[model samples]
Target: MERVEPMPLGGDVARRADAHAAAPLLNCLIREVAQRCPGQGGRRVYRLPGGGRLLRVREGRRPADPEVYTAGAWQRVGHTDLVKLVAEELRRHTGLSNDELPAEMIDSRDAVAALLAARDRVAPPADPYLRSEQSLVTGHPYHPAPKARGGGPVASWLAYAPEAHARFPLVLLAVREDALVEEGDTAALDALGQAPPGYRLLPAHPWQLDLVGGDLAGAFADGRLLRLGTTAFDVWPTAAVRTVHAPAADPAPGADLFLKFSLDVRITNDVRRLWRHDLLKLRRTDTAAAGAIEAQDGPAAWLSDRGYRTAAFAFEELAVLVRDGLGGHVLPGATPLLAAALAEGFDGNPLDGPADPAVWWEAYLRQVVPPVLNAFARHGVVLEAHLQNSLVAVDTGGIPVQALFRDAEGVKLLPDVTRAAGWERLVYCLVVNHLTEVAAALVERHPDHDPWPAARREFARHDVPEIPRLLTSPTLPGKTNLLLRWTGADGADARYLPLPNPLSGP
Candidate 1:
């Protein structure tokens, strides 16, 4: 066996030593050992050519023996090569270098692959209740009935009872074969046995059906239509859908929970577009768009299933219709907290007293930034930490406590496939997209505060305590292009901030 010597752990030698420095050497050693051993799981301690030992750790959870080497045994190894090896693997996998990474981690190659695979295989959900032309004329017979008490008579002969309420204008019952009904319509009320005194029935318009698109199966599967009492509300339909009041008393205990869909598909579309763009930028062009979709959705669903504070909805497609309603009824004082901060605008200062730069900085560092950093460190995921994308939920006293991070479409695995692409994008989103925007807003609001310096100090103190390099980093102009555009600045005046490379331990 070729003997290897572990480096000494003091002075300049210790400073240069890292887990990764040992990876190439360990990898070579492991290959040699595997050739000799040919086993699924095993551990061996070998004395190196140097005065140290190599403790090989092999895990057999998978078909092949996954091996890692720690240079220790005789004396406690202060600078284990395993750290560098893992760090390198992390960089290869997520794009973040060791300095940009979190303090802890949950490593599972299969889990990571599964998540990546899931992003590519997302199919739009289905809605079983929708009416198709072929089904309307052929499978189910449609019987037209006289419009109810307050409503006009049905205009189409094909309108049926259970589905009759699918038409619009609940009060008039103006029958259009395809007109869609609101969740709180009288026809739905009648089905629920809670019809109001002046309830009316209506037929759906044909044009409305055309707007609903083809198969309802996908919509239903995707959670677009949910049952409320006896009526089904269009939860995530593509078009602009609205909710109206029904005269009946609340049916379910939690009936007060109003479910409104989103109007702009841009949020979801942006997520998909960004995800694909990032993947392509990282040179993972071989991975299909389906892969990206699956990767994004899998973690989203996982997080939702695990009960994180995500915007309460199912798919990105559903976000269009649901977000507005969710936004409307956000816990009463929550909007004001966010609005107060956003109203200040985005500039280059951070010390505006009216906005309490200290308070904002503290809250963000202690509460907001930690969770996000922790998530990345522990899970290899960088959440969408942008201002507009995040919701600041506060208590009745107006003190910000909990942060509601929405738009899962933006959450990505750090240390993405390639080194440069993943790291740059992660830095762009975290530092530029989220942090810089907020910093600019703070600075704009408080012109005298010198926002950049304060922000650097704050980030250094909390997010990357090990690396103080952020404090001395120069500004990047082109990088802050988004902020400049938002600030309505032209060319020369916009100040861009450049972040220091993390590894140097600034």
Candidate 2:
């Protein structure tokens, strides 16, 4: 992963980690629980209603330098103190206590610290794409604990972590053909390695293997699963720790593939697993998404989740998804960078050096907005176009030329959800989650540039009936990640609160 500068694990490392950890928590706190209490001089001040405490911060897309009012003055709190403050406020606000989320918040900070330390010893990949994929240190900008690795010991997950520039070979297993349960096209798996006559090839994440080893011991012993050693090539983990990408295979050409696996660890709100229900519905969702993107007029593409394979004995625990890689979709001369990495600053970020902010951003809006709107309006497919799920391909001149959207598991079919619900989700994922972050990053980089006008025009061009209301709506739905976690709601069960709509602003 591209890093900010190298720092010794000691000295300012803890402070830096504190800052990294604090941004998202602060964002969630201010967005969900804290009420705006007028501007304090040039800084933003908020009143935490539950605790009756006044807090102030240097606010932007990513708020920072937090200070709480106390003793007739303001006192800055470290991450530990911030976690305690958040917990106390949530407890009072919700009338319930959550020890786990706070602990995860701390774990997330410590994980950032460990990632910073590990990154110092390693060299970043020469490939800019890999660097972009691994660039997230503060992940999920609005999430309370985006980097928490199930609170597991540093030694366990560090090596597999993408933030540490991790690359490793997949553990190859041969499942008895009769014991394997698979769907759709998974032929790509056979080429990864060879299996015996009665067995099918199944690649596993080493970290996941370690997590579920005991449960699979019986299968191994009884010959339902056979060890076939590791793949010859190393795969790089993406922002999503469980999904891995295999670059061009050594002698074989066109061997690029992305494999998604079941991770027992909880990175964000939910345990990152390839759940059976989603897996069963994958092909249908992916097919619909692919068809929609194909029908769109622009260069936007859908990275289809082609298929999955697993042992029936441990369906959810052992499932691995096959997704189309960048080789086919990306433009010939352009580089595909993770959209999240662009929002989260990376070393060679394309947004950093755009010649004209207007042209670049207009191109970006052109490539990204239409396909998403068309898919929902024309095909009843709602893509999870959040930053993490989107890839923006930029040409050599650092101009965005194409947008590739992925992860069918997160796609919601139209009739599956009511039209209102689907539009709300499309708005949240496309506008609130995706465009807002990109626009914020652009505005932060070029202070004089305002991106919303172009965004408004882009939405105006789309024929969806909801576009008109969306353009005039005074408020946009913002997912309450903090409240959702504290209330122990399912990760998929999204609850939203109103956020000021810049689209409607003068």
Candidate 3:
């Protein structure tokens, strides 16, 4: 396989890490910011509007062979060069300077190198669920630095990295009941382990503990918090990284439970903490989502965020969310897989099988489309139905039978956000981010196939007012992750650029 341009880095692993990290960052640069420059030789070249330097790459879905036109010849760019080049270009483009983004880019590349090396030593989990979780090496295809791990040390995050296929037990703690803060139903937690009198059991993500342990020294010293040891069973980290699957939750089958923790690390566009504001609204939002799903017809399910619990002193750092697991909701005999993993490809992805292309695409639409529309149009609930937040279940025949959506924190209540804002967010998540990736992957494996026509038909059936405009609009809102980071905007604040709508084009 093609790796990064020759570098004095470690080995195949480091070069591979460079290639993986650089591609997504370059994708954002080329698509959202860079303008097409007339070609030279046989290479595809683009002029960076900000830096005014010609950048060239082997053009495809994921661009490679990044070179900058300098002096006389094209200088092959390494990961560090690419980061500097991106930072310079963004500075000129935005007329702003960001000291943090460049470091994040370097940190992201370094994290990938670490993950690559760790995966080489760790065996991927045999379970399809865990395998799918661990398989996202490329990560967010559009984000400039999807794999960045808060710029922390490798040893600090490696043991909990889903990409490394590493699984470990939760570091159980006893928060003095007087110090315990909670919301919603956190009853399921009590079954996992026990706590001493006047102490409530609070399970902590091992990595999060390591990251913020020093920050909580006083609580431990005052006996407000006591380490109650670790869970006897290991909960495998999912693709989301912070959330984990305890396959054995005793009476509550593994499928019926998930524990999401706050990691003091910035993942994707945000510091992935179960923020206090979001946690406070979890019940209202999740209830809206669950009620919407229950009212609809089909196998679609909302993996409700049941509740959260944490110590008052370390609310954000120690908070853990209980999410409904995927077991009871899944159809009988159907196996569920991560939607992102399917698009990105995993060992046993049904999309990779010999299923009929047309039937497969149609089945996929039937399972994924209607519920999302129904939830939005009928109930005014906006779900972050992106690939990672969605799971598709397929039968023994490899045909999708149901769609399950999770991460209530990403959901927006109807009146909570203006209808316009919510619809735009829903459109960005469902169509641009979710469906587009899956459609492209399907077309990639079957070149003659066009997934958009079916997609167009499915979307058209929805009576939502935006459907007509969406069907004919030449451009869809594309999120600007690279620029957003360079400009140092809030991660929750989405800024969009116009992208050619595939449903409108051939």
TM-score winner between 2 and 3, please give it: 2
Top candidate (TM-score): 2
Range of the 10 consecutive residues with the lowest summed lDDT in candidate 1:
137-146
Regions of candidate 3 where Cα sits further than 4 Å from its true position: 1-10, 38-43, 249-256
| TM-score of structure candidate 1 | 0.35
The runs of at least 3 residues in candidate 2 whose Cα sits more than 4 Å from the true structure, single-residue gaps closed, are 1-8, 249-254
Q: Whose TM-score is higher: candidate 1's or candidate 2's?
A: 2
TM-score of each: 0.35, 0.97, 0.95
Q: lDDT score, residue 4, model 1?
A: 16
Q: What TM-score does structure 3 among the candidates reach? A: 0.95
lDDT of 3 by residue, 287-319 (tens): 999999989978899888999999899889999
Model 1 alpha-carbon drift over 4 Å, by segment: 1-355, 395-399, 414-420, 462-472, 475-506
The local distance difference test score of each candidate is 0.30, 0.91, 0.86
Winner by lDDT: 2
Task: Rank by TM-score, highest first.
Answer: 2, 3, 1
Residue 31 lDDT in model 1? 26
Better of 2 and 3 by lDDT: 2
